[model samples]
Target chain A: GQQVMQIPQYQHVQEGEDFTTYCNSSTTLSNIQWYKQRPGGHPVFLIQLVKSGEVKKQKRLTFQFGEAKKNSSLHITATQTTDVGTYFCAGPVGAGSYQLTFGKGTKLSVIP
Target chain B: SAVISQKPSRDICQRGTSLTIQCQVDSQVTMMFWYRQQPGQSLTLIATANQGSEATYESGFVIDKFPISRPNLTFSTLTVSNMSPEDSSIYLCSVELAGRYEQYFGPGTRLTVT
Candidate 1:
């Protein structure tokens, strides 16, 4: 079985501050995907990282995958009130497996 | 990207009652998955529903407790049988589009078992 662990289960930051959440896996993953869930909404797909040591950016958010493909991180620069949500990192059940095993997720709260 | 819709956006059920949630997708998809999210917790994979066959449940889930049906490519249902107070959670349906790494989720059905 594959397990994914996320750090900083909860985070509170002032508006305009930065935030980062890290995810680690017990085994190497073929790819990792990030998702965001609002206060009372379903989880939404954010981004996916496939190549090892890959870095992708969307607006103010940046995603990075470890060289070993066993870990990943999401960093948000100058967070805003709209960034309040739970961020989750998910990895495939196995190599070439479409099923995903999700981490516990990091809940972010921004104070304006 | 695909458009997904779930029936009965939220429901309150008594213990020992069973509730069936329906998931419908606008476009055809190869794989559909069900997930449960407990209060203040993350998402957990419950099962994978493929068209024209039995669902593949996770380690703790079983067919008797969480029976699932995949009648066609764009439709599926999950029935939570003999549910208890602990079963109160949000059930989400997701679909994996062809050649896409990300799975898109439908608006979850919030279930509260009293």
Candidate 2:
């Protein structure tokens, strides 16, 4: 079975500050996907990293995958109030598998 | 990304009752999954529904308690049987379109057993 762990279960930062959440897996992954869930909404797809050591950016959010493909990270530069939500990292159960195992997720609270 | 929708956005039911949640995808998809999210907790994989076959349940979940059905590529249902207080949570269904690794989730059905 594959397992994904995330650090800093909860984070509260002032608006304009930076935030980062790290995710580690017990086994190497073929690809990793990131999702965001608002206070009372369903999880929304954010981004997906496939290549090892790949780095992708969307506006103020940056996603990186480890060279070994066993870990990933999401960094938000200058967080805004709208950034309040839980960020989750998920990976396929195995190579070419469709089922995904998601990390516990990091809940971010932005204070203005 | 696909447009996913779920029926009965939220509901309150009595203990021992059963509720079925329906998921519909605007476009055809290859893979669909059901997840449960308890209060203040992360999402847990309940099962993976494959078209024209019995769903594959994850550890600790069984077909009796949470039966799933995927009659076609765009529709699925998950029924919570013999609900209890612990059964109260948000149930969400996600789908992976062909040739895509990312999965998109529905709005989710919030169930509360009284």
TM-score of each: 0.98, 0.98
Candidate 1, number of clashes: 0
**Per-residue accuracy of model 1 over A43-90 as CA lDDT, tens digit each:** 899999999999999999999999999999999999999999999999
lDDT of 2 by residue, A55-94 (tens): 9999999999999999999999999999999999999988
Q: lDDT for every model?
A: 0.96, 0.95
Candidate 2 ranges beyond 4 A from true positions: none
Top-scoring candidate (DockQ):
1
Top candidate on TM-score is: 1
Worst 10 residues of 2 chain A by lDDT: A93-102
